[model samples]
Target: MDNYTPPFNQSLPQTAEGVPNKNSLSSYLPIRTKGNDFDFDAVIGLVLRGLLRKKVEGYSYEQFVADCQSAFEEKLGEEEFWQVLKEMYFENKDIFTVSPELLLFRAQKGEFAAGDSRVASMFTNLLQNMRVEEFEAKLNFVEREMLSTLREKMKPDSSLQASEKPYLPYLSKAFREDLKFLASRPKYLLSEIESFLSFYGFTYTVQLSLALVDWRSGQEPVAKPLYFIMDHERASNERTHIKNHGYKLFNESATRLFPMLTMLEILQPSSSEKGAIKVPLWEISKGIQESKLTHLKERLEKFARAFKSQRNLDTVLDESDAALDWLGNVMKLALAQFSIGERFNINKRYVLEVEKYLASHFIQNRGRSGRVLVLNQDYIILLTNLVVGEKDKLRFYELITAFEQRGIFVDKQTEQELIKFYERIGNVERMSDSGDAVYVRKTI
Candidate 1:
């Protein structure tokens, strides 16, 4: 069997002249994992990530069920898998959504019942409501229009109006069903805010496994943006009661992550407007590692306040284009902060003398951790390759003076790190005279 390819590697469709077609995919088109396949985990991860990635806005019962069947191959019965996922949704409610409109667990035969999809029934009712005489023409039109309109409006903190909205073919039909599913459980919606906060809190840990690795590898705290965008959304959503659901979301759950800028005031959700449901923004409300690492928490807050690149923060809507634009802005905004240190929290004092020089040339803010001298070889080579062989002309006290004056201190203990690095590369000499020293860089 061919090695199963990931969605990231798919090529865009090209015309004869070799330019990609304007209409080609941005995100790779998803396919059912039912055909002869081998990489079960890849399929399962991507499918689940895709489904849960957008679960907050709700998604299609049909597409989600298809993804579930594709996840286990055809080995699991379609009805059986759907039942499994519907229950999993309750266990991990934040990540999954089950349309209460469907009586998903009705008894059919011994444990496997082919339950009817009420979501499908909603479309059927819409077809009957439209009073179309022919099935084929209207069926295709309604389904396509419904999906297109739904994707367009489901972006962050945005909603569609059924009564006042302009006439779009599937506008009424699509939301009419969703509003029903959302209004399905008022008792659950009005359940303790603690239950909601617990779910919201788990969101932090969900992405932290990957996030902490990146953080250690000199990457930004990965969950920062995820939590930020969630905050931006929840603020807009908490203003009013859910549409037709008669309850406002407990908006306090958004404070789960540290603010990007320490001094900037956090924007509150809009004031309540009658008949409106504030968008549920499952955001974090506190510092990421506050309880255990108060020191780390203080440092992160300092970085947040110190890094002021994103002065004009923008709204992150649901489109891929909008999302990409926001990501670009975010990365660039954090560049000054990033350039200071590829890594953070330098616990040891004194680095290689060479490293100290390399850092001075590269960073603007001087890195945030325990004296973040340029410890990376890639950066060292890029900035100071020429200076490596010229230690002979350099004076020892002058080197010490330069370090002290510039605030780049390296204690005697750190001398071994420099000696080891230079010895590994070879061709360097160290000599001492009357409490001073001269060293020469090897000729490359």
Candidate 2:
């Protein structure tokens, strides 16, 4: 035969002296060391123990299970450990009876069975042990629900019915109980009070009542026609010394107070009628005074050069047109103040400032297109540009003071009247000072 050589000649021999080489023997015999040294069954037992502890301590089932999984992964290699875990605690019933040591030994020996039914049975036992903890968590959830329901009951109703009685008695006992609870939590109770006051009807009533009280206490007896209109309804049975005065002064006071009342009405919804029936009179009077001042300032500017030219002797000069114009402007300004005060439900001071700032720009620019500036009741055609340059401040104040001082000759009494007006409504202090107050400057 032609020198026949075997194809297997290069292959390593199976063994030395008829036995395979060490590396070659591994392929056939498959030298199996411990597949995983960890005892998964024992780990399951440890997790069960932890679950029992957590359940006793009132932890939820879900929380207990999560903790168990976390502990196992932290202590063992995540991959090998969980796989073995699923086989033992989940996939085999033997895990429950077998000690962790025996389960681990069997697992290393590769002898555990796997199936969903076996896992299900194991989980059933695990959940049964966690029942107490689940009940505790459910109890906590129920407590939260009860507390929330109680809070809803304690909250005051802001809606006004035809009959103006207090609605607190209509609330359920549970609501009363909630109020008690809220009272114990002072912070939350205050929050509820704030929310109650925020309701339009409630705010209007409270503000009106407070304002009436303040106005009654603040002023002395006067004989103006305006005051009479304000006190006309109660002028007959004058128990208080102030009401003995003529109603005209009361009407003026009422006229002054009308702006505030109008503001309250405007700020509140039409449906709201919760508190007082009438607006206070002093607020209207204050509003009127402020408007007259602003008008006086404007009219004075026109007559400044004329009066200055006449050496302050322009009093006898006939300026019927200017006087009529000034009167009309004052009326318009008063209406504007009332409108803004009502719309924003703000103080007269704030309303006057906002109007002044707006009017300055409108007059300077000679009006803008499609840009209606409604200041309280006064309407102009220029939007207030908040952006101010360095020199803008001095210029604005100079104009306002000059306008005020100029009226000294043309209408000396009105000029004096305007000075008192500025003291009450204008923010002259903020104007003279250069600070962040500029951002909040209400008028020119």
Candidate 3:
């Protein structure tokens, strides 16, 4: 087991054969040190392109500079022109492009390229499921609230291009339905919708990537549950227990990622487990227990045969006790190859690095608890807007349930804090003292 070879299946999934298998461990997780610059605006750009079926037009940084020069060369001197250009375009905080250095309307080219297109493309492809006519109708509503005339002028021509490859995206039905419902709402701003898409885009990508970590031939597809402990950004000393419980639950969920991936990699390949991977999001909120591996006897026999064939082992261990010993050795081998430790850094790269990058927005760090799941104010507002789509307000209790459906959980203490926060911001209407009678409105 100590001298075991790494089991990396280089083959593409059967559903997507003959196409290039660009999916390595890094491609799946996408948490490289240099690739940590994930911009939400850029994510929106990619998703918009994907939804519109537009090609990556070669709009280079040089071309953009030249365009700026042509547009304002006569209006101002070289120094003044550059200063104005920087202030108007580059320094403008509202501009949403794949790279801030480049314009938003087109795909970037040359040395200043699109940052993290692979991950961005995941969102783009997910949005490709939408219809063109419906998207165009929604775009009309978004166009009504343009922040700048330059953003309007820089918009690409109506001509669009379609993707050559088919997309096979798998998301929980509840999330998928909610996303569509949010998109259909005409009151929401384009930036707000983009924020909603970007956050969920990253969340689903993380879950989907981890779920497919053990992908093999004839294996059942599953969505690994991502439990988020919705933290109250403002809480008093007495509410510390609420946060502690959240931290514990969050750690439990995050730490299980690698072990679950490893377990599926080893166990599922040897058996015929059929059914969609139904993740119990709310059920585990009470407390999570370690998953016990079952059907060891049958799995051990199959694993022994496969191991003997692959490693060419000649040992004849047919008895139950001897088989158990071999099974232990096999488990150790698989753990060494897949788990994050001195031996292998798979967990470090895929799990830890991802959480590190997502901090400040999707995650929160507190007193020795490390990275506990959280949604910052900006995200909370975006989510609230989406959850309250097409409606003036939603019942406070129903709103919490909606959050759960999207993989976010909040306890009673946190719930009270949330209502207070919302009330302070003028988004909640309290009909009675009870939390159930309260109604929350969309800030959009």
TM-scores of the candidates are 0.17, 0.16, 0.58
- Give the count of colliding residue pairs in each prediction: 20, 43, 0
lDDT of 1 at 382: 16
Ranking of candidates on lDDT, top first:
3, 2, 1
lDDT of 1 by residue, 7-48 (tens): 111221122232211111101011111121113222222212
lDDT of each: 0.25, 0.27, 0.47
User: Ten consecutive residues with minimal summed lDDT in candidate 2?
Assistant: 377-386
In TM-score terms, candidate 3 sits at: 0.58
In lDDT terms, how accurate is model 1? 0.25
Q: How do the residues 282-356 of candidate 3 rate in per-residue lDDT, one tens digit apiece?
A: 111111112132333344555655654443345565555433344444444344444433423545554565566
- The lDDT of model 3 is 0.47
Estimate the TM-score for candidate 2.
Answer: 0.16
For model 1, the stretches where C-alpha displacement exceeds 4 angstroms are 1-260, 264-393, 396-409, 423-427, 433-435, 442-444
Alpha-carbon error at 105 in model 1, in Å? 56
Better candidate number, 1 or 2, judged by TM-score: 1
Give the 10-residue window scoring lowest on summed lDDT in candidate 1: 24-33
Instruction: Measure candidate 3: CA RMSD.
Output: 10.5
